[model samples]
Target chain A: MKVLIYGSGQLAQMMYLAAVPLGIQVSAVDVGNHTVVDPISKRSLELSIEDAIEQADVLSVEFEHVPEDLLEQAQSSGKLLPNSEAILAGADRVREKAVLSKLAIANSEHRIITQVEQLDEAVETLGDKLIIKASRDGYDGYGQWRLAHIEQLDSLKNTLSQLDLQNVPLIAEKMVPFERELSLVGVRGLQGDIQFYPLAENLHHQGQLHVSVAPAPDITENLNQQAQLAFKKLVEEYDYVGVLAVEFFQVGDSLLVNEIAPRVHNSGHWTQQGTDTSQFENHIRAITGLPLGNTKAKGKSAMINIIGCDDYSTDLLSIKNCHLHLYGKTVRPKRKMGHINLTGKTYSELAEVMTTLAKFLPIQAFPKLLDEADKLAAID
Target chain B: MKVLIYGSGQLAQMMYLAAVPLGIQVSAVDVGNHTVVDPISKRSLELSIEDAIEQADVLSVEFEHVPEDLLEQAQSSGKLLPNSEAILAGADRVREKAVLSKLAIANSEHRIITQVEQLDEAVETLGDKLIIKASRDGYDGYGQWRLAHIEQLDSLKNTLSQLDLQNVPLIAEKMVPFERELSLVGVRGLQGDIQFYPLAENLHHQGQLHVSVAPAPDITENLNQQAQLAFKKLVEEYDYVGVLAVEFFQVGDSLLVNEIAPRVHNSGHWTQQGTDTSQFENHIRAITGLPLGNTKAKGKSAMINIIGCDDYSTDLLSIKNCHLHLYGKTVRPKRKMGHINLTGKTYSELAEVMTTLAKFLPIQAFPKLLDEADKLAAID
Candidate 1:
């Protein structure tokens, strides 16, 4: 089978790696350059986008922020998985909130704004201290505004007025004081059979995933069920046919939907070594209509992201149970370079390994560094 | 770091997968084709044996049967890990016996013969009913002769005399009735630190590994320790660096060395999903002077080879805790196509997954079919 992946990035590279062993050929298109290249052959194939789509058994995107025209054209080929509706919901916060609301899932109360004048009503309805987000092309703390006070809301709205809100709308949401963030990575097949990986507790630094621990330590069975139910509702509503990552905020015993990623999410990286089937492979299986694999956890696993820095302390290799994965990416500041996965039979043992990993990681970015250090040092 | 692998097969392909994540470049040359190719690029590059030797950071082989000239060239490079001496001992039965005798390792008593005249003395020294084997280029039940009676010995010797035994001698050995077969796959670094994976109970069909279960079932702790000690002794004796898989036979309470593979062996495939560090990554680490990885078994694992068939029962995918890994090889009869790795908390659970896998695997070979069925049904 041949798969055409839009966006030539690390995720696409990894997908290519997973596809190869399945005897699937994957070709990538760099939408930025409008060039199609075979990842394995490193051969530049001069073909029209229509020809590429015509040849592919499936058309997919590495990121949801693909050009709408390209997605529409690809969709016209009747080969795209997770389809344009799913991508739109992932790319636009307004559509995402609407989807959640339609499903009656718990989310932060929010209103959409097409102009600066709507900010007054948004603040009145949601709150004075609100997060004003651009509906599309927003990620990693970009294209968003924070209103600390009612006086500041006007200036934030005024600043937002200069941009073309015609192409993109604004979503102002009430900020919730959540204890911690968690995510559920689940796959739904074309047959509507849903498989949920264990919920993962995620830690982010500067709006990028830094660390994720699977089975989310101290999670109650009821909460897990609730989360899974919420995920199923969203997947069924979308008629999703691939992996969907639903980010959540744990407010007391209840969880609030934070966001949804249409494709495999970084928070599920722990599943690569922790679960019987990796999220990447499961996503491919779900999209291809293959039987869903075992989602059982192998052990307690933690994944630490290697962000921005290309060079990491090779000392991490010295850690007995750690598995380092470096994406073949050229380094840049704040960019996700790769990740390290550590597995242990016990949660505390895995925590110890993560503590050792934290030292080799950029300490400042890892919020639990000091606590992890104290805990690991105490063990010795 | 760059590694030059001598054989191009599934093992080399897996090693390539593991190396890429570590940013290690592996260039492989198939001895059969005598052509070098970069696994990642899939590009065939013309390289003389001398140039390959000169350019490599370390030299290793996926299989033991590399040509003597190429082994000598690799050894002359002064960068061969586990060295030609170790590899030669593995490739030739005569050399292996000599090494075992010198090390005082328990092995079947054997005699080497260069001429048909030696057959009379060989039978007198060993036995009339003996296993006669070509000293080199023999594997997977090939290049071997079995004599049931005295009258058959002369005819076998006469047939053997037609071959050029000048380059390849023959070894006649007394057969031992063993309880079961086991293997220890371990690694030794240049720093002399060694890490041993848990002993594996192996099952072979037609002299090729069919399945391997790690932390060998129903074994005493003392026996496991003895196996580890034996493996350590071999590693130290060879001054071996990189992974070494030593096959053993259990007779009563004692273990005898059967054969050794100087590189990663097929029986260690369970490590892919059942260990903290896989054999492939650890081999790269050991040879590259990187710190040895943890080899602790995560759970009970069973690896079943998918040989000679491309179409398998997809129902196995529905089995919990079963992980299928197809090597992307174009199908052919009697060829190792891929393998499935099954892991569970208990041997019985792993056996259950194995049973499900057996139904999917095309059981063309009688020995494999019977053994798999028996293993599956006996697991209750």
Candidate 2:
């Protein structure tokens, strides 16, 4: 079996690793070069995209932001999993918001603005405090702006006017006050069987996910059901196949949709060590029509992203259940170099491991570690 | 970091998978051709063996029977883990028996026969029922002859006389009646730290391992200690680094040394899902001078080898906690095609999953499944 992935990055590399033991060969298209490459070695496979597509048993994407032309090429092969509609829902905020509205799913009060003057009306209707985002190609806090107050609307509009708003519209979303962010990472098989990893509490630093604790502490049955229901509705609506991540904001008792990622997600990386089957493996299984492995969590887990720093001592592996997954990429500021997954019997135990792990990493590179560790330590 | 393993087989392929997540690249020596190749893809790397040896941070082997010239070349690089002596001990029965005797390890009462005339003395001193084995390149019940009764001793001697015993001597021993065969798969780090996975009870059909249950049922504390003590003594004596498996024959309350493998063993495949870290990953960690991950078992596990068969339905994956690991090998009689790992909270649960799994696999291919399931089902 062979799987071709659209984006050649860490996610594809991970999928390749998971797929190998299942007798599946995974080749990735370096969307940057539009050439097929080995996901791990990044070596050109010397095969054209057409050849790869034809040879693959399934086609998938590592990220939602794959170039449209390339995605179309993959989708037209009739092997693409999750379908192009699901991928586009994650790629374009406008399409995503439309799906949420059509499904009557709870999300932030938002308006799509194609013209500059519409920002004023968005502010008036939604709120003065809003997060304005580009409809496409927005990721990791890029292509976004904040309207903190009514006073900044003119300045924000002036900044936004530099772009062709007609070509790419803006999504002005009311910034809802929420307890914290949680992401439900789930997979839907070809047979419509769906399974979810426990909701993970995500910690963001500078609009990038820094750490995630799975089976987020203090989650009530009501909250879990709400998240799962939203996930079910969205996947079923798209007839989605493969892994989908729905990021949400817990506003008191309800979860509001923040975003959806149509691929294996960072927040669910803890599943590599925390669950019986990782999200990567599950995604491959779902797309390839294999029976999905168990999704049950083995224990509490914390996935701490190793951002932009490779200087940390490998001795941190001495920490029990601390597994390092390095991306084998050159260090660059804010690049997701890799992640450390730690598992424990309880949140407090996970916290202790995180605290110990923090000592081995550069503090500046992992700004959220100590704080998240402190928060989790107080839980039990 | 890079690791070059001798013998491009399933073991090396699995090590490649485990090593990738640690930012390590693993290449394999197709010892048969003496060419370096990608462990998983088996693609020619276009690199010479010497170049691979020089580039790798560590060198190891997938199988004990690597050609002597290749082992010597690897040892000359000063990068080989477990050293050459440890590997040679595993490759030759004579050397292995010598090492056991020197370490005062309890093994079978045996006599080395470099000439055919010694066979008659072996039968006079020991029992009439004896198993004779070639000292080198013996595996999977091959290169062996059985002397079932005093009357058959002359015939067995005639069979043995046909071989060049002077070059590859034979081990003639009384066939001791044992309760079961168990293997202790353990790893030793460069820093001399050691950890062991729980002993696995192996089931053989026609001398090929068809099933293995880890943390074997009905184990007493004393038996476990004896196994661990033997393992510690052997590894320490060799000053070994990387994973080593010591096979034992449990007789009454004691365990006698059967053989030792210098690399990861088949019985430990259950670690892939049933332990905090697998034997493959631990071997990588050990050779790379990294701290070893926890060796604690997560639950009861059974690993069923998919021998010479690829005709099973993958729906067995629908069984909770069952994971399929296919080696992507073309089926050949007695070939180890892949393995399925099933984990459960207890023996009974593991047995139930095994029973369900049997429905998906060919009965002839898995001769031990139903019987082992019955045994485990009666355990708890």
Candidate 3:
């Protein structure tokens, strides 16, 4: 089967690699801005995007942010996997929050703010502390504002009022004091069969994902059920087909939905090394109407993002059980260059590998890994 | 670093997949014919072969049979891994027999034959029952002839004498009535560190590899030692770098060298799902001077080659612990389509999965699977 993917980035590159061995041909739009250079050969193509898409058996997105017109074209063709509506829901916080509310699923308490006056009422109803996020065009902390106290709401409102909030409204949420952050990465097949990877504990730095440890340490039955329950509701409601990642904030024993990513996620990267079938492969499988692969965890795994570092010594691979995935992207500060997946027979072993890996990394390039490594060591 | 591979086939494609995550660029010559279509994009390239060669940091062969001239050019550059001499030894049975003799290794009692007149002497020295193999360009039972007794030798001689045997000679061997076939897949790094995967029990049908069970059932310390000793001899003698696969015939308490492939072998495919690192990754690692990865087997694994069929339902992936690797090639009779690597917690579990898989496959496509399944069931 042939697959056409929207947004040719590192995620698309990985999907391309994963799809090839399955005998599934994958081509990406906007990869060469229509010229479709082979990702491996670095050679330009003679095929046009029209021909590429027309030949594709299925259309999917590598990320949530493909332009709407192209998405509409794919949608009209009725070949889009997971559908454009689901992609839009992930792209827009308002729609995602509404989906959560409509399903009666637990999530952070929030109120949409369209005008400056609504911020006052949002503060009055929600709490003193707030996380104000733009409904659209926001990710990795961009277009997001946090309110530590009600006193700062006016300043935030003043800053927000200058921007045109008509088309993109703000979601003012009461920041919950959660015990930890976790995510469930799962796939929904065309037959509506759902299979979820074990919950992964996530660590964030500067509003970007820094690390993910799978089969999250000290997971309780209660937490597992809650995440699965949330996942079931989302998949069933959307009739979703393809990989969907749902981030959650664990408040004590209760798990509340944080947001959903309709594509393969970084938090699920651990599955590449930790599971029999990776999330990337499962995503392709689901999109192409293949049965979902087994999601059984092989062992404990930790994935540390290689953000903005080009200085990674190939020698780092010399370390036992350390797998490096470099994205081959030009290094820019805060960019996700790639990640290192360290798997072991136990949490302690993974921790030990992580600690050793930290020693090899540049402190500036790895802003959050050292601290995460320290936590893993403590766990060890 | 950039890697240039001699052959552009499934091995090169898999190597391409394995190397991408390591941030290494691999360009394969002779893959898309002289055009060198990018493996990832499947598009023709604009670059010249010389430019591709000059851009490469290391040159390696996906198979031993690369043209001698190309091997000479790569050898002159001093960038070839495993080197041309090792490849030539693997290509020519005479050279291989010489290496075995030099290393004092055990092999089938044999005599080189350059003329049809030598058959009678070979029979007198060896035995009536013999296996004769071509010295060059032979695989999968091709370029082979067999003799059951002296009476049959006349007919074989009549047929053999009609062909020119000047350049390419044959090796006439007394057919050893032993046990099962096995292969040792191992790697030697540029730093001289060597790692060997456990022996794999290979099952052949019509002289083609059908299935391989890794950490071969009923292996003992003596058998393991014998294989490792032979490996040590070959690696040390050649000062080899990159993966080498050696096929062996088990006879009682002894093992005889059958042949050697100076590149990753089909027998190592189980490593994809059954080891912390795969043979493909190790090959790239060894060539690029990266540290050799762990060769520890994960539980047990069996790999079944998908030959001459593309009707392989992706649903086979639905089987637990089963991973399919399809070569993106046109379907043809007797062509190796791809392979399925099934990993399990025990020999019994792997056996069970294999048996279950056999039921789903066409009988024509899987001649040995049902029998292997039955054996596995008995073991279970």
lDDT of each: 0.80, 0.93, 0.87
Considering summed lDDT, which 10 consecutive residues are worst modelled in model 2 chain B?
A: B152-161
Residue B102 deviation, candidate 1, in Å? Answer: 1.7
Task: Flag clash pairs in model 3.
Answer: B8-B31
Candidate 2 interface RMSD, angstroms, 1 decimal: 0.7
Task: Give per-residue CA lDDT, model 3, range B30-80, as digits (tens).
Answer: 743665545554454567667878888998988898877778888988888
The segments of candidate 1 whose C-alpha lies over 4 angstroms from its true place after superposition are: A36-55, A371-380, B38-56, B221-226, B364-366, B369-380
Better of 1 and 2 by TM-score: 2
Task: Give the CA lDDT, 0 to 100, for residue A211 in model 1.
Answer: 77
Docking class of 2: high
Q: Candidate 2, after superposition: displacement of residue B315 in Å?
A: 0.2
lDDT (Cα, 0-100) at B261 in candidate 1: 88
Give Cα distance to truth, residue A265, candidate 1, Å.
0.7
Estimated TM-score per prediction?
A: 0.92, 0.99, 0.97
TM-score (2 decimals) of chain A in model 2: 0.99
Arranged by TM-score, best first: 2, 3, 1
Write down the worst ten-residue block by lDDT for model 3 chain B: B36-45
